[model samples]
Target: MGLTQTGTYNTRQLQIVIINSILVVLSITAVSLRVWARRLQGLGLFVEDYLSIFALALSLGVNALLFQSLHAGVGEHVDTLSTATVEAYSLNLYVMQLFWNTCLPVIKLSIVLFYQRIFPVRSMIIACRSVMLFLAAWYIAFQTTAIFQCIPIHHEWQKKTTQGKCIAFVPFVTTLAATNLCTDVLLLILPTRQVWKLQIPWGRKVGLSAIFTLGIIVCAISIVRLENLIAISNSDITWSDTYSHLWTAIESSLGVVVSCLPSLMPIVRLVKSRGSRRDGKSLTGIGQGSSYPSYVRGPYELSEVSNRVSTGPTRTRLRAGSSHSDLIRKQAGDIEIITEIDQTVESTNHSNNI
Candidate 1:
């Protein structure tokens, strides 16, 4: 089709889309590989994480679709669109605006859901839920505003004629942008305090907390996104470049992933911990694999248990098999028996349900 002043479909947009598509696939793939790395043992986590990853993938798909529609519909316009192009223009704006706005928030919500398993504490979970509620409110407000942003959702052609009747695009977008950035920063800040309260060593706390504090990443990316939005407001219609769209996609995607990365620590550790368990000789979750968490030692029994358990190549039982009772006695033999203890330790931190 021939191009017109409304805009011409440019190769730059396509390139941005292609790169973003690649990123979407790669991100999802990495998460999927981790979830199903060992199919038999880890499949329980598959459903939840697949949804998590799917949201990310879907957001990317929405971006790509909208990217194509905006270019094709707008670029093909002739001088000015007529009754025929009205539907096309309307559809383009509606789809593009909805995709860019809604899909991103959906992805972010998915991340928050995945985190439920990570922070099992009642208070922490409550905090996460509250933040999610706020995100939902923001999403609703933006979507409602977007739907009403244009007059009749089909009257951009005569848009200037009814100037006083409709909301200006700049004010609407700028308000949305400011609120979004604030929410982004708020969501990012919410988790750092929880990370700070972990009982881990200070260095580990800092390092591990950094992973959860990816609000920093969100903050940084939001700054970049703010820049991009400004550029987009004055973007060249005749030219298409991947840089602007690709970066905006990053701004949106990164927030979801940043919120998500914390929840993944348990997954990564579960994989690694399971590997160590297998190599150390555990074929069942309730077997030695489960025993590891409770297998603490005081001086002599540490050596005794270490000596008794052999991860040999052959499935041969050399030492006299010790019962759980015998194991306790052994633990008590060389040191004061840890009898007076109230304990509430779950199996394997089992937060991720692994």
Candidate 2:
């Protein structure tokens, strides 16, 4: 193993610290936004929020464990470290691997749960539930594999101690990376069809698609991380794996941040609303001259509510003197609700007409 040193600090170690530090800040910011959105909506911090917080906490554990590994000489040349220190580094790395596996799925589960609350379509709900189940199974499998991957477990950290054989590290890492990429792609595509099918205009659809596409950033990161993992030589354990370790930290940290963004809709709306007022123009929903409605349902609920009203034999009465814009706004609170109000109102009214 070779070490990169620069002026009193190990370059690899410094890189890990810098990357994980940024991740910690982002993770905290993302979780805070998620919680603030709940408070803004008066949802009072539901289960999904708790799940996200727990995931962030676990991510912090991973970050801390990585730091511990570095302290024990993980980023230095293996020859420079004592056998005992190397063994300690091995143990820290093992714990970090477990936490990394655990944290990713937990954060993903939180995202799925958030989707469930926002998208009420029966099919979408079923899909989200299915994803949740798969994630739960994945979580169990990950922890089990991490725990039992090596014979007699302790040999995982004490590789030189016994003749205990263990799963090949390269294959294990490659497989883990592949599986993570698959899930990332799944999550990235899961919301696209729903987003495109939204009753909003094509421009808005494109804009929204772009937002969901941020998941692609995480996906790209995963791919690079996987490539690094595959390229790492087993000979230089600590030195060669530094890039993989850095990307893993980045991948999980960004996962938490990206998953929490959609939930921050309320905060975004509040900020946009305030900004628009100062410019002498109110934020429009879906179309020209359309003002926001009072009902203020989030984007995720728009389709389900619209579907229910259109399918039912129930006529909707516009609140007295409520204009077309108001009705459109009533169905969804997001700025994109600038859709045609008369059409929506008539359909809703016809559904309810006796």
Candidate 3:
């Protein structure tokens, strides 16, 4: 059914406010926990951390604009709103789009950078950098188009008085939504190949893959948002676009949450390890049979431990001691896989004399 602007109010206004307000609080909490996790591991912030902080800032701006639009009668029928109120809502919506556009790319970049930090293989690094470049270009192109979609910028909201041309709304939005969805899918796939190649046990590899692929939830949100965008009618925009705005807010904030999740793993491990210690349980199941001693290092940092063995040839390999699960858990951003290499080789003569 077509959306008709016959009613005085759409009850969805309250729903939008409630849903988005809760999301804002959650995103803030997720980022805070991420920072705390890093500190618990005694590590300095990296590029991904900074980018997530910046993305959270942008998300807050977007939320502010959304609330402003709601106050400006964005959920009311156009026939019920005063001309000035309509213009106010339109103006808020216009600005919110720009912020939303910028915010999504920033969130994706943060995730890509996180991948770069955790999976330091040469091919993974190259792929991540390529994705980073693509995201930067994506943001520039879409943001530029959104900024100038109307020939005279104010015409976007002041349609009556402004004599100017503007791009077709539905087609432009369709393209934007399609591209966003594509990028989301690309990001979801980027880490899976590298994850499966890890030397960890198959169960551990599956667990890590699950953590990295959490972005699929965000992608599903994007698909729903795109569908809503396609189905919306331009005439009753204030009413029809309510769901669109809701999903956009959701997708953006949820992106932040997903991006921060991996980083928050360290905190989870720390809590679990403490609880296990209190219960007098052993955390040594995964590291059994390894003769090397390994120390905890901050997630994503490489550490090496050298040992001399009298009977064996020199060998080097990735070792996870009693903290194997901790290392696996740190893939979220707190675990480090220690490298252990026997630095000394026993000479045959020395071995025979011994």
Candidate 4:
């Protein structure tokens, strides 16, 4: 059998590959279905969630594809691949190469842009803009480090001795990882303090909190994946060495999922309301349409209540002076509500990726 080579992935690698493929499918489906469900419920096609979902699709796919390539040289063919631990670690570095070069920085940037929706106050706006600048600077520095880490780039996977030509990796990736983790925590945390001030219900506050919790989830991914870096600090290979790849899968996948969760609220509320309508007719019917309809509209108009009347067949007499409230609510609802009806932005990010 000659000297058995370490790089051939064997069944274990295949299994992990399959598992990663499942995550890729789940992440894509969750985001896509969530998007579709929004359209179904009239939540409109939002770019915020869809962009991350699509980016995850690319990042995860590249991770999977590139890892499988490294696995190709495993078995008795020792010379075809580098040392086992090094190959796996480098696979991570390369997967990161794909992500940093193409995806993560972009995802983080778009996420900051989406923040403007929930935060329109001047200072919050400026802070969020600064976050965008931070994201851009990080991306530029990150890709530079990743590119220089492996000489000729092809040597990353091709088994060539990088010899003096490539930049030593520890400083580069660890800095990248630390910076990434820090920013993930910041992006997730910054908006939340501002979100707390919203007059939305406690449950809504909790929901916003849950959405921001994704930042913590991202933090965990960073921390846990750091273990992989430590494992590879000397470029050692083993199933343990690759656990970080699994963490990477999780971290990026969940970021996309959590990013989209807030957008799904309206979809969920819309569905439940429909389900309730199906189960039984309403006594007051005030809560009949999407959400309390009162809550779905903005706080400014619906913030207070007063006498109002409905001239239509229902003859529903609302609080009188609340007409101004209803007018503003109806108008605001008119524009925002239609966002749920339009369904075409879905593929736009795919183009962005291309």
For each candidate, give its TM-score against the true structure. Answer: 0.62, 0.79, 0.79, 0.68
Model 4 vs truth, CA RMSD:
11.6
Error of 2 at 130 (Å): 2.1
Report the Cα lDDT for residue 98, model 2: 89
The per-prediction tally of clashing pairs is: 2, 9, 2, 16
Q: Which stretches of candidate 1 lie over 4 Å from their true place?
A: 1-11, 14-18, 37-54, 66-93, 156-166, 233-244, 266-354
> Order of all candidates by lDDT, from best down to worst?
3, 2, 4, 1
List RMSD in Å for every model shown. 10.8, 7.9, 8.7, 11.6
lDDT of 4: 0.54
| Cα lDDT of model 4 by residue, 1-354, tens digit | 112356344664565567677767766766776666555433455565566666776667655653554343322133344465445545655765566445666567657766775566788889988988888787777777676556676676545444436665555666677888888888877878766776556886786677667667778878887767666534233343455555666666666665656555545655554454343321111221233222222211222222122221111222212211121111111112111110111222221110
- After TM-score superposition, the amount by which residue 80's alpha carbon in candidate 3 deviates from its true location, in angstroms, is 1.2
RMSD of 1: 10.8
In model 2, how many backbone clashes occur? 9
Higher-ranked by lDDT: 2 or 3:
3
The residue-by-residue lDDT of candidate 1 on 27-126, one tens digit each, is: 5655555454324222245334555666566566555654554444443323444544544544554555566677666656655554454455688689
Pairs clashing within candidate 2: 285-338, 286-337, 286-338, 286-339, 287-338, 314-351, 314-352, 315-352, 315-353
In the range 112-178, model 3's lDDT, one tens digit per residue, is 8878866778999999999889988988998999999998999999997779899998788879999
Q: Judged by lDDT against the true structure, how good is candidate 1?
A: 0.48
lDDT of 2 by residue, 6-111 (tens): 4344777877888888899999999998787666544467677898899898888887877677767667777777778778878887888888898889888877
How high is the lDDT of residue 198 in model 3?
66
Error of 4 at 173 (Å): 1.5
Runs in model 3 deviating more than 4 A are 1-10, 281-354
Highest lDDT among the candidates is held by which one? 3
